[model samples]
Target: MIGAGMGAMAAAARLAVAGRRVTVYERTETHGGALRRHERDGFGFDTGPGLLHLPAVWRDLFVKTGREPLEERVAMAQVEPAVRHVFADGSSVALPGGSRAGTVEALDAALGPGAGERWSELLVRAREVWDATRRPLLEEPLTGAVDRAALGRDPYPARRRGLLRRRPATLTGVARAELRDPRLVALLESHALAHGLDPRRAPASAVVLAYLEHTFGTWYVRGGMRALADAVYERCLERGVEFRFGTAVSRVVVEGGRAVGVELADGTREAADAVVWGAGGPVPAAGDAGEAGGGTGAAAGRLTVLLALRGRRPEGTAHRTVVHTAGPGGTTRTVTVLRPGDPALVPDGEHESAVLSVAVPPHRAGAGRPADRAEAMDWTAGEWAAVDWTAPGAAERCADEALAVADAAGLGLGGRLLWREVRTPADTERETGAPGGAVPAPVLAGADGAFLRAANRTATAGLYRVGGWAHPGGGTAHAGMSGAMAAGLIVEGDDWRGSR
Candidate 1:
């Protein structure tokens, strides 16, 4: 394996369970890419997958491996306020990711009279789209030559039943055709862009995002997500998977278009029959400046964050904040805040929920280019030793933006003291080797770029990739499923299940 992030680990776990000797080569010490556990000043937080959704996916992993999952160690509680949206009027609404009836009711109260009925109708429409797109587009890989004729014939059934049309060609058109409320449309489409693709112009299949959230539901893990990672790491050991820390991969060594092994930065190479690109570093962009010597376009916007909370969380009464600050330079700043406790996310806890966050549209560093996956995480133990976790002013401008979001949510922090930390997108990519500082395939764009994400599969043979950086994008579940899917392809050679 070239990277031991979530995808790699899940893949390794699969191969190892099948009585295979799998040596994972990770450039950094950590295993889970975006799903890493950071501990500073006795406080531990899961910097990735802060919110859990699409549960059946993980349940499927445990069933596939016959090995218990880390889920046993952690409990999941549906986020009561699945998401709290506050506008400039100081008016706020909590959008719980469940129940058409309740959500419809909430919509009626928040939007207008018939909005509740509209919500139900939209849910029905979303379900129709999900039933058609889930398998063909999301389950199967979209790679090889773009044979428009052959690709369009896929079973994802982009063609709806008379009344509607399912098309992967355009995003905005689909939205215009289906949703009437601009706010509702924004809510439906925002889920797609979470992964990095601009949803407005993406594709119709991306609508699966809204469908999945509403259909499957969303939740927060009790006692933090770190416990889950540690548990998985421990379980992998029970299955006899060996892990080495503090080592970095120099390159994925390929011979004659075949991946034979990985080269470590320290100049060591390990041989293996198959290699998976779990840690596919930044998918290079078009015109990033900092990327000249950094390798690719994806390297320009690398960013990661670590928000260490000081004093107390918003007193019992919760407040959620998601802020979008359009910088003068055009770069956008985003700060997400989750209040401490809700039976769904955090349990009756001793510590307040470490407000989770991320900033999109990072400042472009330089210009060099490639148009591939955006970024990946490279974790090193030594690097973790050097950071100043106590400083909150690291991204002063971003911090101020976060505060503004709190005020917008009608939250008042009585100014107490404890801890504060910030990591720019550059900081995250540098710390974790997440190329472009991209959030692990957290949001898989639909609409237009869905086909392009199939790049998760490498150009070389015997090399497979899993993790947030892969095609389907990020999610502990997506990473885990992707890893297993690739391992299945390798184990069965031509007979593997789930292989496209």
Candidate 2:
């Protein structure tokens, strides 16, 4: 295995349990690819994902690979009022976790009469999309030739509106036609935006994104999301998986049209029966199998601002809040504020740690030329090549913009902030080695299969792909599922379908 990311580690543990020796070579000195934690003055923050949804993916990993279940390995709880939305009109709504009836009631009470019914009706359609694609997209590994035309057809049931009877094809269209209200439209679009997707281009099937969270509920680990990564790493060790940190694999060693091993950056080669490439970025020795590319455009990264405040966290504060504001060119931008109730994240009850995040163009280190020298460069040509996040005050300026939005949403942290740390896509690139720190969005079915990812089984016989950039797509839960699918394909043969 290459890279000790959450997905890689999950695969390593499962492969080891199946009587296969596993070794992970990670470029970084530490484990956990993006699931990083920053600490200062006893205050810690999760720099990666702040919450977990569809945790059953991780639960199954623990149940299959070891005697201990996921709950026994980590302390976690369902976040009540899973998410709070503060819209541009100063109206707000808090949706309860895992309760459809409660969510409908809360939306009605907060957004006024009949508003909840419109949103609920949309979710009912979302459920159909989820049921149709859940097996092919999440559970099974993409093998052989994929039926792009079939999968590309949007499964989201369209709403019939006037005498013309037109069908909405994009997420934004669905929000406008079905949701109707601007605030409800923002609510629907926020889910896609949070994943670095532009709702304008995203498929109507993207409605499943909201459906998953509402049905599965949101959860937080006690010691930040890093704790979940640590648990997975520990599990790998217990299963006899060897990890070699600070060891970078330059490329996969191909022998007789098959991957036989990997060559390290220092010219050392390690042989293996099969290789799992979990590291993001380009796949090495992919050959012809790598040609199938669909979801590689408009990939954006996240900018997170960790705020340490001097005041106590107000009781009953929602765990997560999203504030929507208008952006340049009539676009809507979302700034999400995460305030987990876990005490381990802060110094004490009197102090609180919060994370404010917004999606932005990924960092671009301007090729070989200095960033300052590339001032006249075109922004649209190279993905993330135009934004110089390392430029002085760039990250701070973005953080300030996000903070202003939070303030308008009544976060009330102006006088209580102690210190803040700004994490940009540049930092994400240095940490994860992904070009431009571009985080991969989850795969959705539509737009002629433009949102699909490369298959886990590559043309190189012994080589396989696993992680956010591969098959099942991105997200903490999807990455875990990616690992399981890869491991199953290796142990049970290519004919193996999926978990029975």
Query: TM-score, each model?
Result: 0.78, 0.94
Query: lDDT of all predictions, in order shown?
Result: 0.54, 0.84
- Which lDDT tens digits does candidate 1 get at residues 131-233? 6555544565435555223434322235474797655454444555566665555555456544544544445555666677777777666756655566566
**Best-performing candidate as measured by lDDT:** 2
The residue-by-residue lDDT of candidate 2 on 1-500, one tens digit each, is 99998888888999999999999999999998899999999899999999998999999999999867899999889998899999888989988988878888998898888888998989999999999999989999887655556778899885567666666889999998888888889899999998988888889999999999998889988899999999999999999999999999988888888888999999999998999998876666623344334233567878899999998899989999999876544446788999986789888889999999888777776533223311211122243443668877667777777887799889986668999999987898899887688788888998888888777888778888888888888889988988998999899998878987
Question: In candidate 1, how many Å is residue 46 off?
Answer: 3.1
**Could you tell me the lDDT of residue 262 within candidate 2?**
92
Span of ten consecutive residues with least summed lDDT in model 2: 372-381
lDDT for model 1, on a 0 to 1 scale?
0.54
Q: What is the lDDT of residue 88 in candidate 2?
A: 86
Task: Extract clashing residue pairs from model 2.
Answer: none
Off by over 4 Å in 1: 40-42, 67-70, 146-178, 282-335, 342-353, 356-358, 363-394, 414-419, 440-451, 455-457, 495-500
